[model samples]
Target: MERPLKGSAPNADDEQLLRGRVYGRDHDDPDPGPLPHQTYAALVGGPLDGLLLDITGWRTEEVDDGVALITELGRWPGGRALYDPRSGEPRTPGPGVSCRFYYSGDTP
Candidate 1:
């Protein structure tokens, strides 16, 4: 999904795309649309860059602390992708991307 420009409201097309798409829904379940007040952690850089992480039930501290995500880059089976919360302006790589993480080698 394309990140909307910072400070820019989502256009009609954006809303249309989000329609009928439910986050974390099982493949077998019918589409029930997104949950209310849904929020996400936009990953920047690394193998999972440009991906939106579901932070629906996460606390403020958890979002601030960032997370170690599982990835398939570098490692044949799997590895951990470390990410950190971004601070200050000019740090966000793009719109909706509040966290920035770099490729610092994969961790098993």
Candidate 2:
């Protein structure tokens, strides 16, 4: 489902789902780690130049153009979904999106 606008207050259900995704629970995956790599897909509009999406650490900020998602560039996991272009996962990165891996600077 499409996410609510940046400044929009999520409904109870939406908020609950967001919380579950962020914090994880018996149903969802745990916090993917401090510096987990991820793919950033633009749900609406086009991509911005020089923008990096670090899956592990990211935040949605409102800019004059709307919402801006910022992330860092890092190493990609080996054959993992984090950076795989085609992992066959239901939520694999989509079109007009970019992917990057991250490192938390902690020993695994």
Which residue pairs in candidate 2 have backbone atoms (N, alpha carbon, C) closer than 3 angstroms, thus clashing? 54-71
- Give TM per candidate: 0.50, 0.20
Candidate 1's TM-score? 0.50
lDDT tens string, model 1, 1-108?
Answer: 554453333345545543344323443466544444555565555555545666666666786677777644424225576777755423332234344444343466
Candidate 2 stretches greater than 4 Å from native: 1-8, 22-67, 70-108
Candidate 1 ranges with C-alpha deviation above 4 Å: 1-37, 74-76, 89-105
lDDT of 2 at 89: 23
Cα lDDT computed for each candidate against the true fold: 0.51, 0.28
Candidate 1, poorest ten consecutive residues by summed lDDT: 89-98
